[model samples]
Target chain A: MYERFWRLRGDKTTIIIPGWQSMSYLSDTSNICWFLEAEFAKEVVRLHKVVGNAVTEGRHIVVGTGSSQLILAALYALSSPDAHEPISVVSAAPYYSSYPSMADYQKSGLYKWAGDAESFDKEGPYIELVTSPNNPDGFRRRSMVNRSQGLLIHDLAYYWPQYTPISSPSDHDLTLFTVSKSTGHAGMRIGWALVKDKEVAKKMTKFIELNTIGVSKDSQLRAAKVLKAVSDSCEQENSKNEESFFKYSYKLMAQRWKQLREVVEAGELFTLPQFSPAFCTFFGQEMDPQPAFMWLKCEGDIEDCESFLRGHKVLTRSGKHFGASPKYVRISMLDTDETFIQLIDRLLAIQERE
Target chain B: MYERFWRLRGDKTTIIIPGWQSMSYLSDTSNICWFLEAEFAKEVVRLHKVVGNAVTEGRHIVVGTGSSQLILAALYALSSPDAHEPISVVSAAPYYSSYPSMADYQKSGLYKWAGDAESFDKEGPYIELVTSPNNPDGFRRRSMVNRSQGLLIHDLAYYWPQYTPISSPSDHDLTLFTVSKSTGHAGMRIGWALVKDKEVAKKMTKFIELNTIGVSKDSQLRAAKVLKAVSDSCEQENSKNEESFFKYSYKLMAQRWKQLREVVEAGELFTLPQFSPAFCTFFGQEMDPQPAFMWLKCEGDIEDCESFLRGHKVLTRSGKHFGASPKYVRISMLDTDETFIQLIDRLLAIQERE
Candidate 1:
């Protein structure tokens, strides 16, 4: 949430972003000056092109903000005046917490949180954000009311083919992606918005410019370099496409999902929602988290959730963050094979003891 | 900027953003990612902590977007808002264009292009921004409005001793620095902010949340590594203090400035007024650019100053951008030593011919 990691002493959490230089959005000329390998340098350029275009279409992506959330706030700002014509932000129940945060951003109390747009009011500047393979619950997506009808900013952060296989290709009016989920490089604050409609994109870009002078050039170039490197890495890994990135991402999540399922089946109490057939859903909380993070909740007590796990060196998000009351916790199926296995083993040991 | 660089066949300007994997926010663990050798990463962090009170004073630094323009925007968002009375943004004219851009983000326009407190209505909730060795004029900062007096964000983007050495230390609430001028990695969007106020820091962090999630994990780590690499490179080259970055930066600017100065020194051919020691200003009637961009006024046979520059194989920003009439023109000081010098050489040659 805060730049907490900067202050904390060394922890086991793996920071996988540094190793991805040549694979991202760096320019070709970048190779000459950077320490990354030539191959990685080329990759940076390749990914950069793909990511940048997603936001800036013709001329410059006019609307600008540090992240997609600012525009979300602006959208709230633009629509808040019409209270009766209520603008609702509808997303899947187990959605990115930030969806509601946007509502808070505008201080628009009018826009109450209604889980996905399917259930919410269908009219107005309703923001329908679908994080492909939703966070906390890794569901690629679900059927939704048409996005063309209103304000739908698809947070495709985890939707990249790297993590989930896209089923029913969604050509929404707007789609958002950030480097954090795709590359495990959450520190770099760069996100791009892809939109078919020019006005929407223009508004978003303009918002950003007004809010935060056009995005940081250094970050943008770095993002561009990383994107190029990743794409190139995926391409070079296999001839046809980004087979490796897709394969690696899918395999990692799939394997972890299996492990989490096994834990749940083993008398471990946790509400596992129906995830999109394409991806995995980790948790279903009974309540909202004020400041607490979500983790897999069980009916019985697992002696210690935080401290004991810390002893095992296994960390999971505390569920208090998602909602008011808390019953279920959340876990991301985003670890390596050994790490996943280790997490499962730790969970099992605790479960048996409980 | 568009993320994709490869897909576009014609002009290769767009680049995609790589995920956090390409950033370097940490210094201890994995380091050394980019092709560019940078010592600025170390200095940036060191100065940020000393100035910001965010970290234990360390010798190393980190990098992000250059100029801290976006960083400033993010900080404004994160810092406390003057909800009672709209926040005020004050900066000297011909200051960094981002001041106004950032000020205009949301709520009330924060960064107004004003000269002093006098320009602003005498009121509260004002953020006085003072750019040291300011952007276009290269003047050392002289304002000392206390932080407790109100909100003050300083743009020490180029306050280093090399370019605009200070005789007496200047004071402010927050200071910003970037690697672009310090290192040659303008492409890497890395900048750091130093603030003494903790509460203000918290608010700035909040604002950052709305923007991009966080700084790039990859870029952060890479910056950590680059800090080491840069220190090594500069040490090898015997680079001294912050001046190492400045020597190169100043050398580049001085050379180009000399060439352009020589031309201006010679003629009734080109007229530049907006440019003090900071930026070079000119006038060519046939140019149109947005307000805040370099302005130009053309008195000679030039109708389209923009076209004339294009014809001369040098790109000059048309004056219309700053919302000024199209009769003016401006040339920024943002180019490599070779490129900028070449541009001046070309212009000087034209003057000689005339």
Candidate 2:
């Protein structure tokens, strides 16, 4: 497909050739988000002066869109899909929903999920995702778990400054990061992964070149600028009210946890009494128990409850979207304290009216 | 891959997915460039307003990159490649060089130029590019051409107000327009096509979605703005020294052409004895064509000539890049008067030294 692209684009093309592109020796700024080798080197060098030398010390940095969905897509494209050797992707249950879509792009020419690595026959498997400090639970990989083999895509999109100090790299595992959480730039649509290997980096680069033509250059620049600013600000913590940001972030989350706890204590809710993090989930058990969802064990039409919640101007995901039982709905703690309170108050009113 | 992305994305994802996206109602901005069936009605309305009301008379007023390259590629992707059909790609020789590339993308590939429609073995060709009031040379199709089979990609990239006063559309052709020449914003990279077939339009949309993840919204906006500015400027042309700009443009081109014409007329030089009116070329016949690339062609060692041009603070593409005779060269009149003069003087000096 790209061969045709190169042919028609003409030899007048100054930036790229049929099979290779020369490193930009002479800087041309027609595009700010080129993300080509030079732009990558230029940006890393320009930012490293401010980020310090840790960036050069084998940090696995993965970059992508608001969801890390693009990152996953990149991973699939970079892997060996055409080899006669069989390969499959594997992830733990209750994984982020977009994984199937990422894997589907490969489609194995015959099967969906292509026998996810966990289910892959011993003869062949390709990639595995191990979420360290996992989402919805913040559960670190148990130190004794002998998980190995296949490429491991470690997502750490949410493990930014507030979850863990940036000054310390979590030895828990190599991970992904995004500004959506750490810098309140979710609207910015930027994400990156920090991989500890060079071959992985080359493969990822090739995949990205094939997809989306790389991220918006303007967005990347503004994002990199903002990131540097944040890293700088975090470094100069001696300033007045410097530590307050994380404190406020924690306080905001803790307040919502307290509301759910109160509801549980009042017999309006029941914790599955599972081993999970205080921050990762808010659960209540019914006949069908899922450890992560915001369970509403009530006698009512699931659709009707969803409509009722919408009517109250509070929004959340339907459990059905996740292919879960209709009796449950999931409420994430991403909302502000005020919105959370409004939601809780509305829920209490629903019960009172019933 | 996305499963890892989701699993690793830390849990603070408090984003409100746009209700329109969930309901799938709002027009996806990404689909705006390609005309999908779902988007055809909206596009027809838009096409009626922007391109011409005549576009709404049928289902195809498609948009693409600034050079119509998008539509050319689109038609190729939709066509069958291995069919035992008499499918042939027919276009005039000295055609838009990109025409063959477009056909190859479809895999029916480029058939040899059979000169005219009477000889064109057009029983089953998928795509044909018929540029009228053709580019380079302003030769509009003179009506003997047959358009019964095969999709036509009209790269009338240069048929505009300033060039041909009598230009008009053929009865059947997929017409294209580019802002690069029409508005002098090649760098903006915006092109639009009026595809007459709805199914073809729909297929193009799908291919584009796979190709580059939609055109640059920012670049599109800039092109629109510049075009509007040019339009407004045109409205006030009589009072705004409109004649002066044309005179300047012509003067600039003519000055460069004079030096070039004189060199060729001197009999010591050889060039396209007759070439496109849009450009003026000169080749070294007796005067050692130091580097064969006096135009985009170079008789000299390609790499060495490129080095020479770079050292001399000049730049010209080589013919090999254009699928033209290796020693042939092409030059552009798309520069300001000063630059054109500089080029002319430089050429003269090189000639004198030879």
Candidate 3:
């Protein structure tokens, strides 16, 4: 998906990690160094502020292997320490699919997975996940539960300008961000949370420490470098053209979404969620639809849309995985150009056959 | 203490991580890639066999963020899935100090910390952690609990030739190893478990997946390179002088132990553990006393060895922290030579004052 952008980046994005870079277990401070580099943390704050997607000031930053790890850490942090019974964890339907497993996998006595927050009428302390520009379906969301006993965790993985308009800086108590979706460096496994409460941040840090003794210093160093490069590119004078990574990514995703929408319209076999043009702060202009995922709902007699796509040699995440109807399928729009082209061709062919 | 070795290594130990390296969450195999790189796993096995320390054949290799993470994973894997109650986790006294916190921090309810296997006379399912060439105090160890219901996980972090004699290949059901202690790359945060049971390996992998997804690819790639370099040096016919990493580490540690012993002998303030000369397969000769930690026992009126050392401007881990007497203090022998020299000077100064 990002081949062209990386081809342009060439050697600038590459980093040499010294064998003895972080040979000692000790970092600057015990808690700080466990999985985070002080420099990397600073860069994360800087990048988020520059993008205007997340509120960094007055927020404690907790780094993780990825947002996936942070998701688990947040759940562990949110759960009551002295509670006799496990708290219920719920998210609305069509949520980020991993929430269920990430919550229940430990079979942790501290928390248990309860379906959709809209129906969660139970009386007790609960954690409700609010994912903005939600996975599977790209829609901005807010927490449905408004109880004093409820805790909210905002997963802002796709809130960056490339994927959505920055309506305002997210000010949730706890919000998750990742370099994978922002800078397209998924392999680095660097994610962070902007936490309002110091106690919660400390507990999350402890969870990370006990879980992995911290994230890899090499990955942290690399993330710092990549994030810096991204910030620099965004701030460049000639950034409007192909030189800026943000502009380049935005253009690619927008173009793909347009082409995909066109093919789906021509086929008339599927319909896409409608997204209106919104003014983006970073771009300083009205932006087109650029969702990370394409939620395609099959029309007519087609059922089990994921299996239907799979039969056409185009693999997609089933809506059932996201606790939705089987008629809907989630296709990744962030894949390589070649993959995108193949997917379009397959969808067009299937449409013709139908 | 290993500064000389690192200085000799210089830039050869550095690795350059490309921005686009291993971007996809997916690996060669879904589970395999999450926990390990096939090549890195192969190198780990090869290096252990070359050093004649761990038996790798017919074993399932599971990688972790660090041996620390694996320690928890092993405990989780060893616990019964169907059991209504949490399993008891026990280790011998003066065990790795992190064992207690690591086991209980999650409050998983899957397992609970039970102190000292020798004193654990419980009649229930239990998991015993046996650290051979144990932490704090270096001594060869075995599982004290011989019951069929008891499961053993051997932590062989210090079983390398530099720390102890590799008398023979260790063939345990579950063995943990790390590049940090063996190659002095603690920052890499890469650890592996050689498991005899496939089911346990799968569970360990699942725990890692649920925890941090998997170990860092960049760290794994770097470890593979370092292990290969270490193995190459060990096999070199001309590595007899000081080129060999193992020989260099052993000689430096052996010399430090000898010098420290002489100073302690003169002071009569503290005493070190005694270990008989043991045959080392790697060196093809009897090895001298070379342990990772100096287990110092204070003599006379020194009530707390740690506090006594602290007064001399030398910091040491208290024996009370390791569930041992306050008269004992554990000092790291793995620091820089300058630090080690300063520690020795302080000890001598305290002795002179006494």
TM-score of each: 0.65, 0.57, 0.95
Instruction: List candidate 2 stretches off by more than 4 Å.
Output: A1-73, A80-91, A102-117, A128-149, A162-215, A232-354, B1-228, B239-354
Tens digits of per-residue lDDT for model 3 on A1-354? 775676567577788865556787666675533556888988888887788888888888888888888988888888876899888999998987888988876668788889888888999789999998899799889998889899999998899888898888898899999878888777667899999998899889888887877788888888888888788788773745545777788888879987898899996889999998889888888886578999999898889898888888989888999989999988899888788899999888998998
Clash number for candidate 2:
37
Worst 10 residues of 3 chain A by lDDT: A26-35
True contacts kept of 2: 0.00
What is residue A257's positional error in candidate 1, in angstroms? 2.8
Worst 10 residues of 3 chain B by lDDT: B26-35
Instruction: Rank candidates, TM-score, best first.
Output: 3, 1, 2
| Model 3 steric clash pairs | A1-A336, A17-B15, A18-B14, A19-B13, A19-B14, A35-A214, A35-A215, B1-B335, B1-B336
Q: Give the DockQ of candidate 2.
A: 0.06
- lDDT for residue B186 in candidate 3, whole number 0-100: 84
Q: 1 or 2: which has the higher DockQ?
A: 1
Steric clashes per prediction: 168, 37, 9
